[model samples]
Target chain A: MKYGIAYFPSKQIQDEVNSYRKRYDSHYALIPPHLTLKESFTADDAEIESLIPELKKIANETDPFNITINKVSSFAPISNTIYLKINPSPELQTLFDKLHSGKFSDDADHPFVPHITLAQDLVDQEYSDVFGSLKMKKYDLGDEVDRFQLLYQLDNGSWTVYETFVFGKEFV
Target chain B: MKYGIAYFPSKQIQDEVNSYRKRYDSHYALIPPHLTLKESFTADDAEIESLIPELKKIANETDPFNITINKVSSFAPISNTIYLKINPSPELQTLFDKLHSGKFSDDADHPFVPHITLAQDLVDQEYSDVFGSLKMKKYDLGDEVDRFQLLYQLDNGSWTVYETFVFGKEFV
Candidate 1:
């Protein structure tokens, strides 16, 4: 089975993202609007089962953090994937590092760019048309994320939550 | 740190359980109304980190199951713990066995008896007074539980969710 980790934004953020995704993104139905924390990785039943404890430890050591989406951005020459750019924070970087280390040490294909995809798989003409208008729009949006979900890809290509890890220590 | 696993009922069920817990259970504020799936066991940070994967496997193999609460019951001789008795199903038993086997093989002090603790640590007279009335009343309440939470104890002797595992296979 294929597994990945992600932070699902609030309903308000999802609704906003979906408004654009429904028109442009082909993958809108496969998964909800989410900030991809870790890219997709393959794991058998035994492999994923053993990784749960480590995931929990990472969650426990980290505190809930805020994310701000100040602007819309795109990967132009690379892929033409447009996204709502998330402002970076030390806490978010630490979490990204933790997942990409040790048991979860799978190097990302691209450098860490925190984003929620708004539209993707566009041709040259449509990509420019969408990116040009979106870049000028301000999106001063943010939310406090307390948890992240470990998701599994269904046979139908849709993704569903396998587990959720909440951030923060039990003790002070 | 100490960790345990449990299934938390819906808010309606929790509210009903809390009605009695607030008046009787000495450990009421420490945790919410829950069905204990695994007893408290000690683990260091590293130990817990390593155990997460197996927990995920158990969750993945199981399916969401239903529980019917039919009557009030008590562990009179064993302990004065009065509870809302849960009628068991095969799925629930399978999950219990999975947790007790292999890496999680810590023998339970008592055989599994699924119940949501309403009142505990009662004196002899109080135990009889509470159990007497509660046993006579019928509770035809039930709920479908799709997830179980791994909880940790806090410094203030309270419990908080560390992670949540949802049940079901990703593919048919």
Candidate 2:
């Protein structure tokens, strides 16, 4: 099965993002609004089962951190994906590095750029038109993320939760 | 620093437990309602940081599981811990075993008992009085848990979140 790791924002943030996504995003229904932490990778059941203990330790060491979205941005030239740009934090970078290290494989096509996609897979005309107006609008939103989910894609191309991990110390 | 692993239930469950905890549990204000997965262990910052990658692998392999609390129970001779009993599940057992195995230490004072403490640290007279009444009332509460937290204790005796691991796969 194919799985990916991501941070799902609070419902308030999801609702706000959906308002724009409903009109512009082709993948609005495929999954909920989220910030991708690790890009998707392939693994079988046994391969994944063996990795759970290590994942718990990663979560144990990670402290929950805040991400602020002050502006809308786009992956132009590279792709027509427009997103709510998450302000970078050291904690986020550390998590990205951990996911790509050790037993896990690192096969990222792009360098880590923290974001929650609001609109994606658009034609060039729509992309330009949407990105033009949306970039000017203000979006000062933020949330403390304590957990990230492991997700798998369904036969219908929709995604569902496979597991979740919260950021914090477990020794107490 | 002293650290431990635990599962914190939903707000509704927390509130319900707190209703009893406020009056009975001496350590109520020290922390919220939780199910302890790994008992306390000592580790410095560097030692904990080194374990993050392995923790991530653990969270990746596990799947989100459910716990049901249909009755009130207590740890009488073991200790004066009054709790809402969580019926045993294979997933819980598997997780407990993983936390105890490999890089982590296993120094459990008691065998694994899945529960959320509603009351603790009571005198014998108080313990009997409380358990007698609370045990009679039914509590058919349940929640789907996808994540667990690592916590550390503060100087003032309260515990704070250090990290959290949600059970799931990361490869997609």
Candidate 3:
């Protein structure tokens, strides 16, 4: 009954990111490398089915946008989530804004900080091991955000895509 | 060819806002009191036509969110636009993001700051007058955002709605 919206990276990039996530995060096997839009909300099958038309409309109108992953960063000294910092971009922000508005609205109380999580909830040794290895690691991961997906988690603590909405056609 | 996405307020609020805008803004009569999502973009008729389905989808998926106008503010020193300040709401931000991300993407290069413009390009005295009057006046103008619209401007500098998209049914 709970669902969220997100953008999954390409296979090549996902594989590389997941490899790191597996070592650092316990939930790595439960999910994939993706950026979340709407975090989580409860909904039934009928409700989700009704939303397809609207989701399609949003996808159709949206143009593909490119995301650039500049470097690895951490929410340290406060939170334990290590993430890939997304470069400042107008397009990404715009896309983020839309996903949270309208019928897809959710409780996003915190300020929008655009990042893709690489690892989280690490202890001292684990954090040191991951950060030590990743501190010197610089990434220039780039990809076109052509589609955003709706995903849901089962009782078994696994996430799966409910639907994938592609950006609408570009007007010539 | 040039278009903007916006949300129109109630007639009562629109009238009140427009009264102030007309006195301080030269272009007040040119448009109504509305919050803009996508500022402006050039598109041919055919291109816009093709975007209807996508726009509809977005509109359908979006549930209407209420907007609360807490006070008046200005974009001063940097810009000369005076407007009503929108209280920070996740719904508004989400709606704004969806509008710009889909096929309806436009040339909004600036950061997304949600405000309803009352006056712009005012003379020094005019700016001072409007700012002085508004700074003392508190506002609590609130309205439900049932729908968002796509609007186009005419050659004579007037505007008209090309389409109106309503939010999907809300589950009880």
Best by lDDT: 1
Could you tell me which residue pairs clash in candidate 1?
A49-B53, A49-B54, A50-B53, A51-B53, A52-B52, A52-B53, A53-B52, A53-B53
In candidate 3, position A10 carries an lDDT of 61
lDDT of 3 by residue, A79-133 (tens): 7788888788788787777767787664787867778888898997888778777
TM-score, per-candidate, Cα-based: 0.54, 0.52, 0.49
lDDT ranking, high to low: 1, 2, 3
Error of 3 at B83 (Å): 0.4
After TM-score superposition, what is the CA distance of residue B15 in candidate 1 from its true location, in Å? 0.7
- fnat, candidate 1? 0.16
Report chain A TM-scores, every model: 0.95, 0.95, 0.90
lDDT of each structure? Answer: 0.81, 0.78, 0.73
- For model 1, the stretches where C-alpha displacement exceeds 4 angstroms are A1-163, A166-172, B169-172
Off by over 4 Å in 2: A1-172, B169-172
lDDT for position A169 in model 1: 30
Q: Write the per-residue lDDT of candidate 2 for residues A1-172, one digit (tens) a residue.
A: 7788888776567777878887888876566678898888888879887665666678878888888889999998888999999998889999998989888888877789999898888999999999999999998898998877776654445454555665553321
Q: What does candidate 2's lDDT look like per residue over B7-92, in tens digits?
A: 87765677688788879988765666788998878888798877666676788788898889899999888899999999999999
| TM-score preference between candidates 1 and 3, better one | 1
